[model samples]
Target: MTDQLPDAIVAGPKGPALDLLHIVQINEEIKSVVAVAFKINIMALNAIFLAKRAGTAALGFGVLSNELRSFSSQLRETMLSLNALIHASVDGVSAMLQDSRYNDILERAVVLASKNKHLQEVIEQRENATDQFRSKLSGLRRALRSSVDDAYRLVELGGVLAKSAKIEAAYGAGFSSSLSQVSGEFDGIVEEIRTSLDTLRKSSFFRG
Candidate 1:
């Protein structure tokens, strides 16, 4: 992902590392993924029931369905964590912006009261606050990247499981067609989640 912020968010030494609106958009996207994951879990349970109805011929398919259900749960959990990280980052950015404004006002005050030692001390304190916020934002960015990577890996594993399910479906005898349809649904849902993640990774916050 590019380190460049989009035109909508101001980028500079004084501006925030990320904007609130952008963070809100990211949260909405993650929510969509969570919704999709929920659907996947339900579909997996249905597939498991169908496999059981098919008897021993669909044993492998049943196992894969169970695995898919577990995977969906994992994906949802990862997304919730990501959402929390984003919220924390937003809080940090807001604090930094407030500190920056205070610093700017203090610097102007220093110009008027150049001989005031107390005002200079306050300015120094504000500067320290800004630095602390920057450090926090940096740590949060790293965490967001790590979480995104974990999510990407999980989605990849889901894709593998979906393909395996499709293969196993072929051994379902009379239930092969039904099993195949469920596998296709799984693949499609996984692809949708992957697409959303790709978009999120391309956002400015994921930048180095």
Candidate 2:
């Protein structure tokens, strides 16, 4: 979703509408997490190949690499869900802002035409629409919150897996150094994802 809201919506006569800049910030952080996930997958593949070259000695390391690959796939799916939630939220917030503007205009018209029966009907319709948008937005936010929590847990799992890979790397015989290097890379990438998600969770959209 675009960061810019309509000027009329942003500078509503009532006051500034909801700032959408936070949504943009949230998207950036999610993109970062997604990129890190991609890197994790690549690293996992490389580790797997290295483990194979180390023969039976690196059997445990090979198993950990496969788990890491699976974790990366799960993380990618979670990020996709998050991106969809963010888009839905942006649409909902935009609709709410537009509705607020219409209500403002309708209120002024009502004051000027107090005896106009049709104006009341229009105002009621707009109020109903606003309520619907609000309810939808609330649900989207809840889903977004849950998805972020899932992402956090997955990253924590990745961290544990990376540590396990490091331990297994020690048994890689002649390939121990190469396996260790790949495992270290896994640690770094997982940490990067963790940090990105931390920032995303702190964004205003995630807060109550």
Candidate 3:
């Protein structure tokens, strides 16, 4: 059960820190994008379903739904760019993973010591990089690294939709699209989550 999810996965050993500081950051960014793209696609697909039920009345709000769809397209484009980053990270780590000299230097750090948000932000980025490689350095390895970064970016986009939902409620404006969008996105999050976790489990790390 635990092996089926990459979210809580923490790497154990079998490697040194691949000298990939810059590429690692790029990989996280890509992960954020893939996550976001999955989310947006689900949202748009849900919106389509909702609009169909709303009938002609929903047509009046077509412009709004269209705008939301535009956001989804942009998110996909961003994910594509992140795909390139994933390739680079994979290339850097492939050679290092097979070497025995690289001991277990790829685990999580202790606690984050930061009073300021900026410093804390820096620490969080560093933590995610280590966690990303620790858990996913093999198998999909770097290919999925970009996908993980996309997940965070997806959450960020959700933050926008959540706020928009609040606005939709304030004036009694019936943008049911907001509700359906979120519902669909939630479904997507669950699915990809399972997919990623299952993938990580099949890696050489857990070989019996």
Candidate 4:
């Protein structure tokens, strides 16, 4: 009887629903940030072409150099930040499970879910910021590519290198900040789930 599925776990099955929703939200955010970052990169390269066309190619580096790098870094940071949160959440949960503390693990999971909701709200802020410049990012990218004779691949390659820190930083920030909100507040729920997982994982009635 101890090994059997709990009524809530078996009957409700909201795990899959929550999983799919989280995945979709993460995907949408990643795509949005990547698209924006990529555009900034292309625009940066195109400044060179614009310089050549205007016969100021010689001074192009002086004029747009600062803007291009700054803008590119900003967009890439956004993408990296989003990616970080996703990784942190996954890793935090995994670590909790590995510690063999069911109560602690359940408590952490609930807190993470709450943090995840907050992350989505932050994403909404980002979406709103880009509404006015919906196509501008992509348009600048195209113009830059045509102007500089650079392939899209090169820009993407540069982006990969520049945006590395964003994911972890963003994820950890959001998760950790709200973590205290749910900490130690769900003892009953945590105990219940902890017991359920322990029983399912082993024959022993009591865990050390």
- Highest TM-score among the candidates is held by which one? 1
Q: What's the count of clashing pairs in each model shown?
A: 0, 0, 19, 8
**Tens digit of lDDT per residue, candidate 1, span 1-208?**
9998886455434256345556666788889999999999999999999999999999999999999999999999999999899899889877876877778788889899999999988888877877888888889978987898899899999999999999999999999999999999999999999998888888776553
What TM-score, computed on C-alpha atoms, does each candidate reach?
0.85, 0.84, 0.39, 0.32
How many clashing pairs in candidate 4? 8
- For model 2, residues 103-167, the per-residue Cα lDDT tens digits are 88889999999999999998888788787887788888788888898899989999999999999
Cα displacement (angstroms), candidate 3, residue 90, comes to 1.6
- Clashing residue pairs in candidate 2 are none
Specify the poorest-scoring 10-residue window by lDDT in model 2: 12-21
TM-score of structure candidate 4: 0.32
**Root-mean-square deviation per candidate:** 5.8, 5.0, 15.3, 24.3
Taking all chains together, the TM-score of candidate 3 against the true structure is 0.39
Clash pairs (backbone) in predicted model 4: 51-57, 80-166, 80-167, 81-166, 81-167, 84-167, 84-168, 85-171
Q: Which ten residues in a row have the lowest lDDT in candidate 4?
A: 199-208
Q: How much does candidate 1 score in TM-score?
A: 0.85
For 1-208, candidate 4 gives per-residue lDDT tens digits of 4899889667752332333334344445455546655654564455334334434323423244334456556545644554554454334333333432443454566577766766567545645644433334334323322322222333333334333222211233334232222222222222332333233223111111
Tell how far residue 41 is off in model 1, in angstroms.
Answer: 0.8
